[model samples]
Target: MSSAQPEDGLPVRRVITADSFRALKFKLSGARPAAAPADPVSLPQPPAPQVLPQERPVLAVPVEPPAEPETVAHEPPAPLDVPEEEPPAELIVENAVAAMPEAAEPAEAEPPAEAARPEPAPEPVPETAPVVAPEPPRVEAQSSVPNAGTTAASSPSAGFIERRVVERPQPEDPEAGKRAHALLDIMAMPTVGSLPQERALANDTLLRLIPRMPLKSLRHLAERVCVMESPSQLLVRRLINDSRIEVSGPLLEQAMTVDDSDLIAVAASNNPAKLKLMARRRIISPALSEALIRSNHVETLLNLLRNPGAAFSIESMWRLTRIAAGHPVLQAPLVTRHDTPSPIAFQLFWQLPSELRRYVLSRFLTDSETISKILTMNAESDGAPRKHADHSLLSELEVTAPGEAGAIYAELAHVGRETGDRIAEDQGGEALTVALKAAGLTRAQFGAIADKRADAEALKAIFDTLSFNKARVLLTYWDWAARRTGPYARIAAA
Candidate 1:
């Protein structure tokens, strides 16, 4: 130990151990003394914070204060000392990077490398590329004439043309029959599952061949074609008026393709057989019946009357009755028609056979006596003169011969009857008037004489000469008689 002097000039003496000297030296150097190790059991722990009754304290204690946590100024961590490895031979580059000057300023503007090196010119593109479109379907060109399958040199019956594709006939080809047969064979080919195009092709081929086919072959073809489910209208129409009955018969009977106009044309033609076939069709229009009536073909008209499917206008029925009146065969069928008009039925009643007449009477409520009276009236009224009678003379005769008038009329009527001269029975208008006036005949008496005399005109003349009241009574009776007879009778009476 050594004594030391204080700055106040006071001498101080102190004894120092080695430990104290080491501690002093460390203190001056600002170094803390290392703490000695303590026993684990002896180490004092801090007091625990207060815990709420409801909460349990966790085992992990927080290291920092929540309110103002202690933040240590941390120094950056030292870089890891990783061992360096030698560069691979492939990664080594021949050109070394040039060292930049430490004090060098960056250049204000650098020229673009793209401007220095000219850009490669764009490659030219062709304007059009090869585009493939689907090809249109090929339809074989047809010749003007349709007999291409046959030739002038070929025989008419060219043995069944196995593979004949009849497109269109050339004008030079004369064997039209052979071409028709070939086209028919193609159409007859089993079309059960054939494509629409194939059926259409066959149809087009047949249509073209039809006009070119000879008459005989066309007729035979028509018979077969008419039986098809749906035959072409054009083909059926062409065959409908064919001059030969064989050709037109099947078409008229079976073809639905024949329009009413075509049927009418056929009916109008001078072919009874064709018209007869038309009458036998499944259905007939009123227009067709009229056309057949105009044809005046008895057999055709008869057939039309018999066909249950035939429709007739009132006019047509009347015309049929008029024509049928002379035909015994037509009368039976016309009477059987349920649609026969009442007037026509009455007209037919007179012509029908006894058995059919009973049938007609059963259908209508016509009075036979009334009809007879009408006939009598019509027979009398026809061609009767309209000469005015001397009404003044009638009055004078009534005054002079009132009692003898009845006897005179009876004698005159008897004499006229014996001579078989209706004109004598009628006498003159003046004489008939005078007799009627002198007799002062009642309506019933006048009607009986008029009907018996068969002279309605004479009755009219007598009526004209009578007094207005007497004439009215007679006129009413005559009107009733006319109504019972017929429409014409009624008009005449009026």
Candidate 2:
């Protein structure tokens, strides 16, 4: 090193010479030439350490010394004769050695470069060993850059940089979606374009298989079958009568293929859920209506009564009225039904709550006189023997009369003539109230002929307020239903 002064007169700056640098490098590297032996021959020198310019010299000094030097007697070499104007190389070398870790001194005697590559060390350079020294950290550092993937990919532990080959998802087939939709469309069109024999075979196969189908499959089939315009009759009947309402409900509600007999069979079942579904059918027949009434389920009965599509025989209405008289819940729907006879409404009147009773009276009573006149005129014009009798005289009669009046009363009691005679002989009881009211007889006239043990006042109240046309219609239905001896006949007889 040499010191020089600037013209600007700043502090002295020291400049390093090439020879001093080389001496310092050889001294710290543990490869200084061995001291001359007493013999004239010179021993081979270990390879000099090579240090990277970028790395500090302290890290490069820790290279292992050669094996031959370990056995040799040690002697400090003569110092280089530096100029008096410059700092000595020995001072720089000693300072660098002191800064190195003390633990590296034993390692200074073993040549790591020769041990790492013993095959052809004739080139005698230790640069290859130190070059690999800082490689691990360099490799680790390079991993942080984006492009380090190419270098680190060879290492198994570099999981984050691993390149995986993923197959791109194949495009979905358009026909696959179309085919899936076609499956549902095919389900709706079960019987399209088939031979009669084929259809029959298909139907028979379905009938046998449907009963054993899982509940979910059966329900799906049933829901699908019901909406088809002309679904197989056997299949429809099977599903309509399924024990599970979930399987049968859609058929009962929407299937047109279901016959009235099928519905009657459903009504006969103990399943109130099925009975309710049957009652909710559109355009229910009178027979089916009677069957539903016989079901004796309050919900079924209420559902039937509320369904405007349900057509009740006058007998069914009578039976339903008796049911409503017992179940207050059945009253409102039974009374409000448009198909329900006004006579049945009148019968159900006392059983209803105040609100319903008011509705019945207002609905059935307003047109009583006009309805009575129309009925009488229709009967008289049909050439009935009673036509010429005075309705005004009959309406005004507040007391009982005999002879001609008694004969007229007997004639009125037998309005169905032969059927009335049978009913009367069978102890007509309530039938007589209906009969007398149908004849347009007054409350007092009805009282005179009714059994003395009977509740005359209650019967009179019904007769006074009864719709005349409705009563006559009930009378006709009773006569017809009595011959059939239906459940309604028993109700009428009661």
Candidate 3:
């Protein structure tokens, strides 16, 4: 300690000096020096106690002891309350003491976190209600800029970063595409070669597997087979020249099991070109030839018929005539033959109206012969084409079929040929009227065609052929057309 002036009125003490520090340490520990025995010399007697002021021979009596000579000992922190299932409390205390000096020190400074009393410790919990522990807060790592300093150690480099590129896989058949395209090119050609060319083409070519050689190509190939032409020879030589496939299935089957019409209609769609005319040929199927005659398919059918070097047969003529008779378009170009149509074909023929039957039969047989054929054919058929027996003509004459009787009158009225002899009788007016109206024509048109007015003969014929209602219908039509024009003007409303 020292005294000074002229500065602020504060006392100065050399507290940090070595002497003070030594004194502090000595006082802090309060440990006295141990005295040694006097040995053989008698120990000095204890000094008599003296009153401090009365015996004041000492210059300064240091009265006050060091303010805190007592050491400030800190209490050890209490052991934590963990479950017995866990390690013992003493082990936890030992662990914490080993981990952090602070954990053990704090309890000495304050009180143990809890006293180790046998009675349960006051829980580190609120007194009133059990607490719900909150979860520790999470922290997200933000993406960083380049040169980001990572806690992760630097990556190691070995053969991993030093490897070479890998090889890719190869195809199974590399030239297959070229072969396929080449085959397509050959198939695209228009024709096969001539016969010798055909033999060459068929002998060794890729085309052998195809059962049908195209027609145009077959034509060329047939020529080559029989004649032997140019490079056509060389090309066919490289083609199917070595191969053999079945070729007789068509002709053999045609000769054995098949007949004519089936041969045409059924096989035609499949092999029309092959079936075309061959000179002096007997056509097994002519009806089919004439069928497309009136149909829109006629063009394709005709091409098959007019194969230039080939001619058709008697059977073809029979079939053509039969079909042409039915179709108005083919009627002009009649083909004649003498096969004498089968009984069934003739049966159907005579069953039709006499006029149509005569027209058709005229082509097959002479006029007189056709009439006799019809007579014979009629005798054999199911009587006559069906008739409406209750007709007006029934009571007056024997004829009952509306169609048959209609035909008779149609002739007498239109051609004025006096069909009267054959007819049951001159027809009644009602039958004639009905027959005319039902035949689908206006009275005027019928009159103009017949070259006569609705005369007594016409009236008789119409009534004779008609029912009461059919007759009245005709009369009504007359009334209507006349009112619109005239003629039936004779028959007024009453």
Q: Which predicted model would earn the best lDDT? A: 2
| Winner by TM-score | 2
Question: Residue-wise lDDT of candidate 1 within 31-146, one digit each (tens)?
Answer: 57555235322223322222234322122222332222122123232222222352211111100101213333111111111111143422222222223345687533333444
- For every model shown, what is its TM-score relative to the native structure? 0.38, 0.40, 0.23
Which one wins by TM-score: 2 or 3?
2
| Pairs of residues clashing in candidate 2 | 64-110, 65-108, 65-109, 65-110, 65-111
Off by over 4 Å in 1: 1-208, 211-216, 353-355, 366-494
lDDT of 2 by residue, 395-460 (tens): 433453432344443456435445545434433244456566756666666677563745666556
Q: Write down the worst ten-residue block by lDDT for model 2.
A: 106-115
Q: Which residue runs does candidate 2 get wrong by more than 4 Å?
A: 1-192, 367-491
lDDT of 3 by residue, 242-318 (tens): 12212222231222223344434433344323333211123333444443332323333344344332233544444
User: How accurate locally is residue 112 in candidate 2, as Cα lDDT from 0 to 100?
Assistant: 22
User: What TM-score would you give candidate 1 relative to the actual structure?
Assistant: 0.38
* lDDT of all predictions: 0.53, 0.58, 0.34
lDDT of 1: 0.53
Backbone clash numbers for all candidates listed? 5, 5, 53
Error of 2 at 125 (Å): 99
RMSD of each: 30.9, 25.9, 31.2
Looking at model 3, residue 39 earns an lDDT score of 35
Instruction: State the local distance difference test value for candidate 2.
Output: 0.58
